[model samples]
Target: KDFKSEEEKREYMLYLDGSNSWILKPLNFIYNLNDKAFFLNSDHTFEDAGTTIEIIRRAFENSKNIRKSDVNSKAILIKEFVDEKNAKKIKEEKEKYLKLSAKFSCNDLHLELKNEDCQKFSKDSIMQLIMIYAQYKTYGKFNSVYEAVDMREYEFGRTECVRPLSVEAVDFVKLLDKFEDKQEIQDALEIANNEHKNRIKSAKKAQGVDRHLFGLKQMIQKADDKTKKDALEFFNSMGYEKLSQNFISTTCTGTLDFIGYLLFTPVVWEGLGVTYLKTNDEVIYLISYHEKQKENAKNFAKYLNEGVEKFKKIYS
Candidate 1:
């Protein structure tokens, strides 16, 4: 403990650096909660600062279900479902809502998968596709879906302007229940894979419609009345009822490989964040969710494993 006084740390925070809420959720914690085996221990050294920044940027950038606004400029704000939810809480109700929502946050589960079992679907496809399918089967509903994309190949003003590789992966998930024929199944997979590939391409080319609208939304929020109303109307048409549950939910941590020297268990603020990682022979599935409110992290993890197993029976 080198710090002799609390004032020293306060100086560093008050003047040296300060962050707003926009960057709060992904500030990157170096320690664990109650000595939990969640964080990537810096005890094992690395050549670059790859693990932290890349994982953080990829998750946040790629998780948007972008919708466009009426504005001509790239400054049009994209309204999300959460933005439309009429959370009209009074003073006392606000306190209660906070307490209730807090209870459902900060949770995770650890599981493993066989690489061979995931062969046909590939690691990314099988994990996302199966998870969405399970949610549909379990909830029997439609909602928005988002996934993170790595946009390192393209250039942005920043180090790497990456975003999520998002698509309506749920559409493919629905196909699983719709058809049993071999041809139908093959066709669905092709469509799903094609959607996945296209999303990556769109994001890399800076044609990410969602975030572009989100940026517009940001500007309009501070703009005059005439522009804001039209922007709000565009979002109103989309409706907010489907937001009660996110399809793919939050894109916290995607895939990580620290030369086989990293341990990752990402925490999700919405629905769930699937952290796909691996060791020598085991593929680790770390599902992070809020506390058990409705369907939780554990059941999602269970359903996903079961969903994959059923697929294996047919394909393998």
Candidate 2:
């Protein structure tokens, strides 16, 4: 991949910039010679995390097969050898435990909840705990909460938003805050779980409210002048602004064994982004946030851990 000269490299770079053929193969290979590492970068516009991970796994598998064939061949094949000494030094320099206050931090907390616990309580039960923590952090008010729902069942479909904040969720959180009655709390939790399930179902069917409103806004851009004026006025209203602010953005990235961790910045400056995976024996969360935001990712993780313990006690 090396060019003949500096001028040739410059020309090749310009050619890539001007060519549209790169869109057909949108994967980037990054290598760190000092650390002896290889990284594959996939653009989010073309692939979601799930698809990207699958692609990477297949690519690695193919490479392993090729290496196996080379082992049996008598012909010599050029290979890049790893610098073990330098790689070990680089690995040692990287911190094992990172503080959440660092810019664009990520924290992965593995909980004690098992697959049996997941079966005993719905996923909504876990989400209810998250909502309670959000309320605690926001001083007893439920902010706009979002969860991404994959809509790839339809042709050319992408994702839809599932707003998790609801009247039932608010009631459940409030009851847990004030009362300790087991039956009352269980009933409220069940109601909230049902409401959440319904919302998720609606989103999966592409009947969610957010995307519909978004589509309307897009259409308004090409509407007649009078219609565009009214649509713009409505979309620009204060109520719409409040509704659009997602204070807690969350998504469950499924239980793919190859996925070690996932992270994304908060949607809004003061918001929190949470991507989680539930394994057979534990739940892992990768919480992300801005350092200067009012909310602290570490504190939120602590609250969520406590909430998990409380949930375990309730079901125990």
Candidate 3:
């Protein structure tokens, strides 16, 4: 507003200290004289020194601010400008292909459509492929978003030759069914041997186990009349007291649950000079001798029956 002469503006620009101005550099408005030469010859040349620099600086600043404001606005504008109904166009383009075997190529869609790779496909195959892609994309909500553009590639008369197998067909066979023909008995033996070894190791190392230690003595001392009466009845039923009297006390120190031991640990009898007899799928101990030693066999038979009857009463 203070500028009153043509000389004022020329000297103002020509001698302006903008070259030393830090503010002008950041705004990209710092003007060398040669670049500002055209403006020097223009009609509004009578502007003041500080005022002209401030005005030019403000113009650049306003332009930068305007651009910053327009970033989001321009993006929305471009999106709004696109045809929202381009799904139909996309579908029409894809409808030309009968097979989509490879990954989609954006570089040569036109050439791909022009090629003879596509052949006639069944409508059912196309429908199946459509469902596959729809299910893949929508994660099972194909019923709603089926008409979207992203799914248009599915309607292209294309079919995937590979179809997923059913759950029953894929998962029905048990492991035993597959492996039994090869090594069923070997696998069973392996498992049984491992269990036996673990049990033997645990029993040998069970130093402080107190659950069943002194169990018989504890029960006898704590017995009510009913328990004492039950014990007497069991002895009477088996004549167990009379039978045990015949076997020396030193040989039969441990009262064994002989039936349980026989059932679960049949291997124990193999070392005791007795052969196991299988009759009606039940195991019975037999003493077999080829030398006609009938006395030894008879003694073994009595001992076996005595042990069996004693175990039956105890376990029962």
Candidate 2 per-residue lDDT over residues 26-96, each given as its tens digit? 55554435444344544456766666566768976887668564665474554645488865654444322
Root-mean-square deviation (CA) per prediction: 14.9, 11.1, 44.5
What would the TM-scores of all predictions be? 0.57, 0.72, 0.17
lDDT for model 3, on a 0 to 1 scale? 0.28
Q: Which ranges in model 2 have alpha carbons more than 4 Å from their true place?
A: 1-40, 57-67, 70-102, 128-132
Better of 1 and 2 by TM-score: 2
Instruction: Pick the lDDT winner.
Output: 2
Per-residue lDDT of candidate 3, residues 1-316 (tens digit): 2334543433333223333332222222223454333232111223322233345557657776686556563422223232546756644544432122011110000001111211232222212222223222222211111100011133431111121111221221121123333244234323433433343344334421122323443575568988877765654554433322211100000111211111110111111122122222232332222223334334434434433232122212
User: What residue pairs are clashing in model 2?
Assistant: none
Q: What is the TM-score ranking, best to worst?
A: 2, 1, 3
